[model samples]
Target: MASKNCCVMFMIFTVAIVQAVSYDTELFETAPCDSNACFDALHGALGDCSCNVDTIDYFNNVKIFPRIQSLVSKDYFRFYKVNLKKECPFWADDSRCAMKYCHIKTCSKDSVPGYVDEHENERPAEKYTKIDQTACSTDEDHNPDLGYLNMTISAASQYEIAKWNAHDSALENFCECDDRDADAEYVDLSLNPERYTGYKGPSAHRIWRSIYQENCFRPKLNPYESFPYVLSSDLSNMCLEKRVFYRAISGLHSSINIHLCSNYLLSEKGVDFAAPPEGEWGPNLEEFQRRFDPSQTHNEGPNWLKNLYFVYLLEMRALSKAGPYLETEEYFTGNPTEDEETRAAISNMLSVIYSFPDHFNESAMFNGGSQAAKLKNEFREHFWNISRIMDCVGCDKCKLWGKLQTQGLGTALKILFSSQWDSLEADPEQGTLPVRHKANKRLQRTEIVALFNAFARLSNSIRQLENFRIMLSANKEPEVKRNVFEGGGANIRSTKEQCSSGGDKPRIWS
Candidate 1:
């Protein structure tokens, strides 16, 4: 027993030492780089670090794989998976080569010797593996402004959001075309725009229709137009590889939303270049841009995008908190028209379904039965997809409610699939069968409406939970009580503990 205890103690001691060393090494490597030391080390670093590890073909290697097609064709023909590895740490240096594997000096003063300790051969540079330099040039020329790439990204994002908002507003006006309009010199627009006008504008409608088709519909149908704006500077005069362009722009729009929210908070407080008014609510601009900017060395774009979305949720929480304190929080107000847009989309979809006989016949005549059949399949698949989503979400209450609502529709669908269509059409008004089928269709419609309501409620719940997680992460308080259910307060200290420890699994919709 004594010998066994001695062995156990020794094993524990060994494990502890190893863990301590590993933690120390990680801390040392991640330490902030000293500017002067890094400069000196990088300058004195002799030759290009050779890739000893086996390298696979990197499709984003622009030099080796030059662009042969135009930018339009490039979007269609582009083929490359996003490289999630950290960019080359020595991005500004000329000696760097585009490789999957290379070492980077950590630039820590203790790790890499300062000028005073340079002669002593005491400190050695740490080797950083998994540096992706697919965007780096093979030539000796290095863009001096490479360091300011993140800042450039932030500016470009702001520009894109502003442009998109203006474009969206213009499209809205075009969609609301009418002839009963006066000159724009001094027109007092009503708070609520009339849904219907008693006048028609065939010419104006035609012009707006053409513009909408060209701008919005065309972009949706095309590859190139839909491609996100790649982040490269006019100042740097650098051309990005196709993969780099795609990867960089993946989370850019989402990041742009974050930037706008951040700017709004700043503007509200009447201060510029300050921390978030909520106090470290989420990652700051620099940290956010660094984490999500695919151009950066340590880019965790996807993870950072998720984090930024959480930040958005937090911002929304702040907005809600501010609401009770005032009549309205002007800065981060919700879009009032979203519910209208949803209802409009659903109404338009239902109108199409109701008028399918005439529309399908016309489409069949013009574009063949295949086109009509494709659309029919799409509608059929949509219903099935909803069912699948409900199943996958594993929400028993939702599924139960769905079944209760669509029991008749389920029966009708069964008969439609099993029964001969020709026979059914021949017996047009077969007793109570037709009546039951109509009732089934009506019930299906009700189910769809219920599903929409459920989706909204569940979405709101998920957002609230995400906000709660963020709060738990930020707050040091041990116990926090939350009203998760109506008329019930739950002690969520365990949930908070789980979140703080990063052990909480992603929640499934109930």
Candidate 2:
């Protein structure tokens, strides 16, 4: 009886310990980046496994889709687990506070700095060593998505460029199957004036058109003729449809500007006039009081909102030029160069998406030139394509999609808008924060549901998890499969029954 009693006590204590042991997610809430050990214990490791464009490109082309099943529904958890481990240096992963996230005290236009090193009050930032990830090899059981996020972005870019050039013969030449294998001479980017013109800005497509008219369509067709990112339309038409291409570009840029998004959201310029605040006008604001009482200044919104606008301005200036980057051999030569034309073009186009708030700004696209609701539809079409790309890589928690759909755009929407702060603040009376509006709204919902949906038939169950793993292993998560059952219920009864269909079908992802 004495021995049994001791055993019973031990069992009780053991159970308590088990229950107390937290998931990586829980640890994120309790303690974030204060200690390096905290991130390690929760996120698994903290070696130099940072990601970049080349790596992302490689993964998208090879392994990203393969790791979706194992961790699909766990995006919220993953976000917590990989917060400091995966997202830091550029941003904070403070899992404890709801309001503080990906929160950087200050940011630089250059590479993001380590958080703890910059802020003594903050926790230790996770640092990675190196990863020996290859494009596609039958090697390990680790998340294949982890290995190729950048490649996925590149592939998506290729897909978008292809869609734009679908109508032209020369445009077709720019693809993999072109007659001269237009993709082959990409090494000569510097020499091709039409394709490689160093000029870049909002009018980049114009240069592309100039190239086509002079070379590609001019009689003999120089087999060597190349135009930077083939043009699908004239400059004005491209600008009109800029929202289409800009959607993806905006996503990519927002991803690059992740650290600044939260701040941008709080900016007065971030909000669309069509979408206003839920509250009534306040009286105590110093700026407001000053305006009404005299000898005072008009404070339209908070500093966060003002800062949000500045961030957008900075990002837009950079986004407008995303095109020349393709013209530089960098797109093909795999080098680095961002021309003014490309940036302007990218910015003008992307502004349609990120500048969604501006379109509705009771001010109406006066400066942005957008009409109410015109860009909104185009925004969804663009976002849908981008969603498919991320979906292929096992990412479904994307905030941009919800924003594009107006299905309650989340804080992630901040990433999709441009800085209209100047105009807002300029009003001296009217101001808003779409960035905060979107982010706060998104925070109200579960962050990981869609990530699970990204994987086909991933519901809550052992069978579902097992099926998911197999599909991810083969990079087949995005591929369509024939399920044993046909259409049955009106909606899904539960997550348990959504297990993936067995293999054998394939379709174009985007």
Candidate 3:
């Protein structure tokens, strides 16, 4: 009995330790750098890695995607075009780009006082090294980005440049040996101008007509026979679409880097908006105090409402761009003939799907019963395409790419059970106005019930991506692939069953 009790205690302790450990903790530990480090270290490494046009051309052909995906998400590579220009120091003529204006003053090592030896020969004496020597510099010819890029590229083992590699320590060298591939290039922008001269802003599509007329269409079939041949719009349009996708994806990702999305995930139980104190107007304290007495009206409603509203708008815009691409029959099913274009579109879609939840998790504040129902309808229509992609591309690895679409829908469903929708909409000053104003602004109870039902259906359709990743990682067998999609419904039901025990209460962001 004593031996049995000791064995039971040991077993319990082992299970407790195992349960306490995180699956991702080890995965991240082996990663070259954390997310935060990637921002600065990668920036610094790229600065060093940027060589002249020749080096740029060489790296453009190199394949790093296969290596990058082992640790980092492949979505990061889409920014390669912008990164090539922004991160790399480009000189049309690398030789002429000089920093000859810089002048330096140095102290001579022999200038230190010396001690006399027995043979009357002067012996050198030790002296402190003075690093404060002033150096004259002219800003007229200095390109700091180029200089830094050159210096980093000059280091060995840290980065790979044209005939140059950084020989720095692992910690100092962000670029590993596997990052280098001197062979064929994976990205080709040879036809499109390296830079888009048109209004390259968030709303790039608006200037598409102007861009096409000026830069895109003019190269081909010029009246003058002397003009060189130009590539058709086939590649150019893809590049433009990718640019829009990149900007859209970057905007959403920037929010994550800012730590605005630390709390929201599909697994989260509730989302509570940070309600600001009532009677306080943003940006005008004096006007707020004069217009409204603090004692009369209620203070502190949902503070995150305004931010969540903006996030919703941004999310909608991103989804609008990504949705059409994913919906296209050709893109959903792989194009065997035009594989590159299909792959690019698929990559963009993945970025879009991945970023949706990051922004959608904050969207609980803006959701109403009707909105939830519409989302549910969209999810049913779209889930098949998403699932098709997952089924074809290893469902365990790719399901999250599809399920990210319905996270907001699930949140909407959960929130409807205990909605403050009526209270929020009834307040005249709450600024619940839509883009277009209407006579009937409030949602009906039937719509709310429909929304709850919709969310329920959508929620049941997909399972947690993180769980799938863990399962797939643990079980390498091919049988698990089929089991994953089928098993998703079972897991969703189980999760719902657990949540039902808590009375399906709308959890507010705490």
Candidate 4:
């Protein structure tokens, strides 16, 4: 009995020591990199794309980021149309999230500006003219600046009336989701920001699991295995197209995790886990570490982070390619001043992106001998299916962002790989390809919004990563204590004790 007790104590002591070492290692791995070293680390050939991370970092921080922020906040880009009431096709369980944060507050039709009800007899152009006139006249201030703004806005509205194309039904081929459903409604994206909603556990995991298992074109390894394990396998042997698919999905996953960590609800002394309280929200370093630190994420953190950059470059390349199309599109929201500003911001963003010498070459993809066409089709189908899976997500907020980002990515793929690129006319003087007017190939307004917004999300994630690194390096992270229930939920223990004893499994959330 004495010997057995000694053996048990030794095992417990060993676990404690190992857990302590692991915690220390995680901290060390996440320590902030020197400025030069960090940029240098990001410099590499990601798949077919080669870019200087320093250049991307500088452009995004100084030039493009601010413009994207401004553009997304504009009237045209702020509203998103989605069918939140769609049932999950994969499973019968339609129990949506119960958490308050999980639900999105939708905008009423009356509150949405420039929204044209199909039941009304008035044409969109005429309605927009009325709204624009009202906006210009309502202001009490008759200053010269206000007059200039109104003039610019009116001009923009007139220009949009001449050029704007209604939502194209044929463009639905690029997106898998049914956006034309009568039940669909416009959501004010600014009001429903993507943040931590405490929607985690089996439901969240199942969604990602289905995505990776059914959608990603990976070799038949164990399909039931965890994502990190499957991702960390020998990906070097995979074909370029397959690799790109996997990396893009992983990049999106990393971005979602980053958003959650950046805007996590900090645990306080009087925090109640039973109900959703308006808790203090800020960066939670421990949550960041759990999702991203190499020591905790099966050594897949660095790879996932690198993939995030790859996706950014891929989407940026698509934007660069679609410059002519974007420039021609009108952003009319009935508010002329805001519409003009939106166009200017987009133009500035494009200029900055165009100045960058290194952009991903779409031609490098889908070149696998005789199987190239087949492979390309497979790639498109897989991404489309992934977009469809967004409907299965239990959280309304997560579903909203998921559908937008995925649709955006799908649009990028269409721009890159579709036959539409062949139709672009080259302008020798401009040194850019201007999109030829093809009725079936033009990008829809929703797609344009999704494309830029998705890029903005990825850019923000990269910035958040840097912020978290600084916080970790400065040792300014507050210790978050989680309550561990014990003895039939009567006794409470600290997360420290749970960590030391190896008594808790890692919590993976979306």
lDDT of 2 by residue, 355-436 (tens): 3222222122223455524444333333333322221111111122211111112112222342311223221222222222
Off by over 4 Å in 1: 1-369, 375-379, 382-449, 458-478, 484-510
**Root-mean-square deviation per candidate:** 34.3, 31.2, 31.9, 13.9
RMSD (Cα, Å) of model 4: 13.9
Report lDDT (Cα) of residue 455, candidate 4.
Answer: 88
Window of ten residues with lowest summed lDDT in model 4? 485-494
lDDT of 3 by residue, 1-510 (tens): 999999999999887655433211211112121111111111111111122222221221232122212212122121111111111111121111121111112222132112111122211111111232233354879865565422221233322331131322221111111112222112211121111011112122111211122222122242312111121222143222222222222221122111111111121122234422211111111111111121211111011111112232333322332232223323211225443454564455334334432222222333557865553333232212211221121111111211222232222322322222223222133222121222122222222222222222222211212222233344332221112221111010000000000001111111
Give the lowest summed-lDDT range of ten residues in model 2. Answer: 487-496
- lDDT ranking from best candidate downward: 4, 1, 2, 3
Question: How many steric overlaps are in each model, in order?
Answer: 1, 58, 24, 1
**2 or 3, which is superior by TM-score?**
2
The positional error of residue 14 in candidate 3, measured at the CA in angstroms, is 58
TM-score of 1: 0.19
Q: Provide the lDDT at 141 for model 3.
A: 90
Worst 10 residues of 1 by lDDT: 494-503
For lDDT, the strongest prediction is: 4
- Candidate-wise lDDT, in order: 0.23, 0.23, 0.23, 0.64
- Spell out the clash pairs found in candidate 4: 153-336
| TM-scores of all predicted structures | 0.19, 0.20, 0.16, 0.73
Candidate 1 per-residue C-alpha lDDT over 1-510 given as tens digits, one digit per residue, 9 for 90 to 100:
999999999999997776444322211223222122211111211111111101101211221112211210111111111111222221121222122111111222222111122114311111111232134454557764663333223445556665675454332120111111221011111111111111112221221122122211111121222111222222023211112112212222233323221221112232335643422222123322222234332222333233222322222222122122112111111234543443344443233223211110111111336764453333233223223222221122212222221222222222232222112222222111222233212212222222222222222322322333343345332121212221101110110000000001111122
